[model samples]
Every structure is written in C-alpha cells, then in structure tokens.
Target: MSASETNSFRAGRIVQLLFGIAVAAAFMLPIVWLVAGSFRPGSEIFTSLDPLSIGTFIPPRPTLANFGSALGGAFRTGLINSIVVAACTVVVGLLVCAAAAFALSAMQWRGREVVFAIIVFSFLIPEEVVALPLSAIFAQGGLQNTYTALIVPFVGNGIVIFLMRQFFLAIPRSLIEAAQVDGAGWLRIFLQIFLPLSRPALIAAGVILFNAQWQAYLWPLLVTTRADMLLAPITLGLMVGEHTSDYGQIFAASTILSFIPAVVLLGFQRFFTDSVAMSGVKE
Candidate 1:
C-alpha cells in the first residue's frame, strides 16, 4: 500500500479507538457520579445539579458514613438475601439449563426443532407478562415469602437454555458417537465429556443466571411482602419513602450492587466472550 493510504489507515484506527473510549466513558459517567455522590452528604448530592461542574462529579468533602449506613439495618439483610437468592439460583439454573440444552442440541428426538423454537420463543416473552400469573400460582401454592419461590422461577431460564444450546450445537458430534460406541450411556457422556468440555459456556451461563437473579426486583416485590425476604433492589426501593429519602445511602447501596455483578462479569469476561464467539460459529 502507498504511504498516504497507510497513514490514512492509522488515522482511522486512532479515531475508532478514541470513539470507543468516549462511548465507554459516557456509559460509565453515571456510575462514577453515583459513587461520588455516595461519599457526600445526602443534602449535598443534588446541590451541584443547578449548574453542572466538577463538584457535580466529585465529592468535595467525602465521608464513609453513607456506606456505613447502607451496610446496616434492613439494607444489610437485603444484601445478604439477594446474595443467597442469586447464588442458589445460579447453581440450580445451570444444571437445569445445561440439561435442557443438551437434550435439545445433542439428542435427535422427535420435534426437536419445534421444541428449540418454542424455547427461543419463550425467552422473547417479557417477564412482566408472566409475573402476575406466576405470583397468583405461587400464592395458591403457599410459596410466597420463601426462598424456594425466588430460586424455582429462575431455574428454568429460557435465555440461559438458549445460550447453552447454542454452545452445545457447536460441539463435535464425533465425540458423542465415539462415547456411544464405547457403550457409554447418554448421561455418562454428558457428565464425563460434554460438561467437562463446556467450561466457558457454563461460566457464561452461570454469569447470566446470577445477573438475572441479582437484578430481580419486580418479581421479588410482587411475591415477597416480608422485610426479611427483601432483595437488594427492593430494599433500595424501600429507602425512598414518600416524605423523605437518603440519597447518600441509596447511592452507596447502588454502587455495591453494581460492583458485585461488574466484578463477576469482568472476572469471567474472557470465558464469556469465548463462549459467545464459539456459539456464533458452527461447523
């Protein structure tokens, strides 16, 4: 290529990199503001909002008091409750989704394509549409205010099943055939071979499951009226009373809530990306 063309290419690459960084910063700005506000007094949080300035994004006199308050009382219980619910859901959800994905992708049963299509269709349906009916059903079964109620609904996650199924479809069929030839049963093959080889996909699915349960607010609000069973988001909701609110504590809890999931996703980001890429490419 000519020197002019090479220079143009380098310039284009630099522009693209800068644009990407700008976009990422734009997205992160709110989170940064939230963290900043959390360290300031509740009254001072919105004080700089009249005309935005550096003070808007930076707490001049920062304190740990908000975090201290956030980590105590009902909010503390809510954090623990959310953690327990999300952890339990991830464990149960992975097994259920993996099995469903395996059956759909590996087995050549009747109506396999139809079943897969249905699963795809199910994920497309908004949770809000089903939340009311699910609440009624759970109420009838006397499962409200129980951890089982929270964990059970999330175990059969359609998106996780779809993700796992896509990953499973990318696996070589020769492995399944060879295992069968060696007199290995389907369960044995799945446990010993497929599960062991699908680490990236499993991590991706686990992350998805954990995030789903972690961010769950509407459903938890509808089902559990008890303060003890309050999830983090619901607890955050309660902090905003009609008469007054505590912005500092709110932001602190929000930061902690966002931080946990961000850490989880970042920690397994490579595996998540690999799983997504592999699922996209099929032989």
Candidate 2:
C-alpha cells in the first residue's frame, strides 16, 4: 500500500477507536456517578447538580459513613439474604434446568418438541401475571416469609432450560450413541459427558438465575412481609420514607447491590457470549 493510503487507514482506525471509547465512557457515567455519590454526604449528593462539572463526578470530601450505615442493621441482613437466596437458586436451578434440557435434547421421547415449545412459551409469560396467584397459593400452604417461598418458586426456570437445551442440541448425537454403546446409562452420560462439556452454557444459565433472584422485588414483596426476610432490593425501597430519604446510604447500598452481579457478569461474559453463540448453531 502507498504511504498516504496507509496513513489514511490508520487515521480512520484511530477515529473509530476514539469513538468507541467515548461511547463507553458515556455509558459508564451513571455508574461513575453512583459510585461517587455513595462516598458523598447525604446533604451534599445533589448540591452540585445546578451545573454539571467534575465535582458532579467527584466527591470533594469523601467518607465511608454511608457504607458503614448501609452495611449495618437491616440492610446488612438484606444483603446476606440476597446472596443466600441467589446462590441457592443458582445451584438448584442449574440442576433442574440441566436435567430438563438433557431429557428434551438427549432422550428421544414422544412429544419432546411439544414439551420444549410449551417450556419456551412459559418463560415468555410475565412473572407479574402469575405472582398474585402463586402468592395466594403459598399463603395457603403456610410458606410465606420463608426461604422456601423465595427459592422453590424459581427453581424450574424455563429460560435456563431452553438455553441449556439449545446448547445440548449442538452436542453431536454420535457422542451420546457411543456412550450408550459403552454401557453408560443415561444418568451417567449426562453426569460425565454433557455436564462437563457444557460449562459455558451452565455459567450463562447460573448468571441469569442469580441475577433474577438478586433483583427480585415484586415477588418478594408479595410473599414476604417480615423485615428480617426482606431481600436487598426490598430493603433499599424501605430505606426511603415519605418524609425523608438517606441518599448517601441508598447510593452506597445501590453500589454494593449493582457491583456483585456486575462482577459476576463481567467474569463470565466471555463464556456467556460463547455459549449463546454456540447454542444458536444447530446440527
């Protein structure tokens, strides 16, 4: 290539790179504001909003008092409760989803496609539509304000099952047949082969389940009434009052709440993307 042409290409590439960085920073501004606001005093949070400046993104006198308050009392309990609930959901939900996916994809059974179609349709239905009825049923069953109410209702996630099934479908049938011919039972094959090979899909499914439970507000509100049983999101809501609000603590708590799932998603994003892409590729 000519020198001028090479220079032009480099200039174009630099422009694209600069544009991408600018876009990323724009998207990150809110998160940056949230994190910065967390360290500011409650009275000072909105003081600098008249004219946008570096002060808006940077707290002049930062303090840990908000975090101290946020991590204490009921909010702390809520955070722990959220972690426990989300973790339990991920573990149990993954098992149920993987097994259901294996059955639908590996085992040749009558009405398999129909069952999967039904499962696909099920997740599409908004949870808000079913929350009231489920809440009533749980109330009747005496499961209100309990971890069982939180965990069990979400154990069989259809989206996770669908994602796993798609990934499972991409697995070669020959592998399953070979395992069967080697005298491996269906259970053994699933345990040893499919599960091991589908780590990326499993991570993706677990992230989805964890995020769902972590951010759950409406269902928890419907099922749980006790202060101690509240999840982080619900506790955050309670932190606000009609008369007064603790903006600093709220920002700190929000930062913590957002950080956990963001870290999980970032850590597993490569695997998640790969799983989604491969799951779309059918034999």
Best by lDDT: 2
The pairs that clash in candidate 1 are none
Candidate 2 Cα misplacement greater than 4 A, ranges: 1-4, 49-51, 280-283
Q: Model 1 misses residue 40 by how many Å?
A: 0.9
User: What TM-score would every model get versus the actual structure?
Assistant: 0.94, 0.95
Q: What is residue 47's positional error in candidate 2, in angstroms? A: 1.1
lDDT per residue as tens, model 2, 62-131: 9999999999868999999999999999999999999999999999999999999999999999999999
Error of 1 at 256 (Å): 0.9
Tally clashing residue pairs in candidate 2: 0
Error of 2 at 132 (Å): 1.0
Cα-based RMSD of the predictions, in order? 1.6, 1.6
